[model samples]
Structures are given as structure tokens and as C-alpha cells.
Target: MADEVRQHMLECEARTWLRNGYNTPERIQELTLMIANRRGQVSAERLIEEMRRQWRRRSEWLN
Candidate 1:
């Protein structure tokens, strides 16, 4: 479905952003707002939080 594809693309974009050290609060907030505008506030909040948690875990493992 189109929605599924969009969600996947958003996830990929978020991952790329985080991987590239764009995980700062300002960047996350900007991304959250962008996604929320396109999707919904609840979904955007949940997705960003999940991505942040995953990124943190990876960072911990690396360090």
C-alpha cells in the first residue's frame, strides 16, 4: 500500500539521519514536526521515540 511505502521511506530517512549524527534534539524535533505534518502527531511521536531508542542502543554498543 502507499501508506506502508511512505512509512518505510520515513523510517529509512530517520535511520540515515541518526546514523549521520543528526540525532540531536533540534534535528529530532524538526523531523518529528515534518513527519507529524505528513502523517499524524501520535504516529510521529511513536516512530521518533522508537528510532531514538534503537539508535541509542547501537551507539552504546559501538562505544
Candidate 2:
């Protein structure tokens, strides 16, 4: 369940980036590569941290 939530959040964030023109296909490919390369070195904690960071940024902008 948690993993599903995380994935949905990831997709949401990616869509937000793409819709706002902050993401290009090449950039997405690079980010995909980064994730692919972090198979063993990265943790779920770090991924959640990034999601929190994005939420913080959005919240700040809404202020």
C-alpha cells in the first residue's frame, strides 16, 4: 500500500513537472537513468524525502 502511494506520488510529481514545462523527454530519460542506477545504493527513505521536499516547495509557493 505504501509503495503504491509512493508510486502515485511519483507519477503525480512527474506529471506536474512535465505539464509545467520543467521536464523534457531528455530530462526524464536522465532522471530514469538516475533511478535505475540507484537500485542498491538508494533507500525508500530517500525517495520519500524527495517527495516531501517537492511537497514543501509546492506548499511554499502557495503561500
Candidate 3:
């Protein structure tokens, strides 16, 4: 199903962030909750966009 694919992609991306040490515990926790609450209820594009926004904010903070 499309939702399955989206969830898979989201998990993959989260793993990448974890592997790269780009995610903080708090951020990871937040994302986990967001994904849990939104999966099936929201589109993959929207979820990824939210993650991207978080990534950008973190990047800005780091810079």
C-alpha cells in the first residue's frame, strides 16, 4: 500500500539521520511521536516535508 511505502521511507530517513548523528534524543522522540500519530492519517510527502523542516531548523542552529 502507499502508506506502507511512505512509512518505510520515513523509517529509512530516520535511520539515516540516526546513523549520521544528525538527530538529538529530543528530536528523535518528537519525530517518533509525530510519525506514530500521523501515519496513515497524513501523506508521506507531508511527513517528509515536516522532517525536512526540522532538519533545516537544526542545521540553522548548528550554523
Better of 1 and 2 by lDDT: 1
Write down the TM-score of every candidate.
0.60, 0.38, 0.38
Tell me which of candidates 1 and 3 scores higher on lDDT.
1
Judged by whole-model lDDT over C-alpha atoms, candidate 3 comes out at 0.59
- Shift of residue 38 alpha carbon in model 1, Å: 0.3
Candidates in order have lDDT scores of 0.75, 0.54, 0.59
Per-residue C-alpha lDDT of model 3 across residues 1-63, encoded as one tens digit per residue: 999997667655744664456466676566656666767434434555556665655644343
What value does the lDDT take at residue 4 in candidate 1? 94
Best of the candidates, lDDT: 1
Instruction: Flag regions of model 3 displaced more than 4 Å.
Output: 25-63
Q: Taking the tens digit of each residue's C-alpha lDDT, what string does model 1 give over 1-63?
A: 998997777666667667767687998888889889998999788778767766866655444
Candidate 2 global CA lDDT score = 0.54
Q: Cα RMSDs of all predictions?
A: 4.4, 8.7, 9.8
Question: Which residue pairs clash in candidate 1?
Answer: none
